[model samples]
Target: MAADGPGKKKHGVLFDVDGTLIDSSYFHAMAWWQAFRREGLDIEMSAIHRRVGMGGDKLIQSLVPDCTEDMQEELKAGHSAVFSTFWPSLRTFDSVRDLLAACSDAGLAVGLASSAQERDLEVSRHLLDAASSIDAWTSSNDAKESKPAPDILEACLEKLGLGPEDVVFVGDAVWDVKAGAAIGVPVIALTCGGISEAELRDAGAAEVYDNPRHLLEHLESSMIGKLMTGSLDA
Candidate 1:
C-alpha cells in the first residue's frame, strides 16, 4: 500500500489493552501461574507478572524451558480457561473512554495493538464500550509472535495502514517498550501495569505516565500530543 494514499490514516495511536487500558495485568499473571501449576511447573507469581505482555507461546518457553510442545499447549489452554473466570473482574482504568475519544477528536487514528487472543479482546471491548473511537485492533492470531518482538505491533500498523513513524505506542509494561523500540515506534509507558517509572524509562520508554487518566490529562504536552500536532521533529 502507498504511504500517501487518498484515504490513508496519517498520525495514529496504538494502545496495549491489558495494563495500559485495563486493570487485568495481575489477573493475567495469576492465570498464568495457575496454568503452569496445573502442568506441574510451579512458576512464581512475580516472574509471571513480569512476563505478562509476552505471547503465551513465548511466555511458556520463558517460564518453563523444559516444557514440551504438548505441555505448552496444555498450559496455554489452562491459562485461557482460568483467565476466563476472571472476566467479571476486568475493568478499564480512569478516563479510558475519554482517552480514546480525545485521540479521535485530535485527528489521529486509534488501534488496539494487544497481544491478547480474540476472546480476551472481545471481553475487553465489551467492557470498554468505546469501539466507535477505535479504527482497528489486532489479537494474538494477527501476529506470528508477540511483545519484545515486533510482530504484533507490525500487525497493528498493517491493520491501521499507518507507518511506524506515523504512530506512538501506549503500553504499561517494559516488554511493550522493547517491542515498540524493535519496530521504531515510541512507547508511552504507564505504571498502572505494576511496573515502576524507573523501570519503564530504563526499558527505553519515551515517557511514563501514571495511568490512562494521567496521560489523558497531559495529552497536549505528551509525545502523543506533539505527534498529533506535527510539532515533533521525530
Candidate 2:
C-alpha cells in the first residue's frame, strides 16, 4: 500500500542507494578495507564503516591521510576492484521492494542519486530492484562536485524536469543532507545505513527514521508525505 496522502499535490523522492535502501554499508567497508590493504594501509573495518557514505575519493583521502595524488588514485582503483568482487553477495533490506512499490503506487516519481560510480550505481540499481521502479538517476559521473555539494541533487532535479521544491532527498549520510539542504530540497534521513539520527538532524534533515519500512509504516502522517502532498511549509 502507498503511504497516506495529505490532500495535495505529491512530489518526487530521490533516494540514496548504498546504505539507505540497501544493506551494503559494511560490504563497502570490507571492500575499502581490502582496497586499503592493497596500498599497505591496515585500517580497521569498524573505522571504515563509520565513514561509509563519504564518496570514494573522499573516503580514500580520509582513511589514508597522507597520500600523494597517485596513491589516492591507486586506492580508488583498488577499492573499486575489491568492491566489484563482492557485488554478487550484496543484498537489500527487508520490505525495501514493498516500500518502492508503495512509492510508485502512490504516484510519486522516484530517483536514485548517489555518489557511487556509474558501474557501482548499476550494481546497486539491480540489487535494490530500482531498475524497474526508479524514474531517474544521477551517478557520480553526472556531477563535477560530489556530495556535500548541491550539484548532484540539482542535476537529478534538472534531469527529472523537476525543481528543488518538487522533490525530497532521502539519504543516510550527512553529505546527502547538506546537498539537499543547499538546494532547498526537503530531506528525510534514514539511520539504516549507519548514520545517527542526531547527525542527520544536525546536518539539516527535516525528519529522521530508522529505515524505509518505518517510514512506510507512517507514510501518511510523516513530514515527507505532508510535504509531498503540499500541506507543509516549504
Q: Scored by Cα lDDT, where does model 2 land?
A: 0.78
Candidate 2: tens digits of C-alpha lDDT, residues 113-178: 777888988788777765555677878888887767787787776666677887788888888888
lDDT per residue, candidate 1, 100-189, as tens digits? 999987888888888888999999988889867888888888888777898889988887888899999999999999999997999999
Q: Residue 141 error for model 1, in Å?
A: 1.1
The candidate scoring highest on TM-score is 1
All predictions: root-mean-square deviation over Cα? 2.7, 4.4
**What pairs collide in candidate 1?**
none
User: lDDT for each of the candidates?
Assistant: 0.88, 0.78
TM-score of 1: 0.95
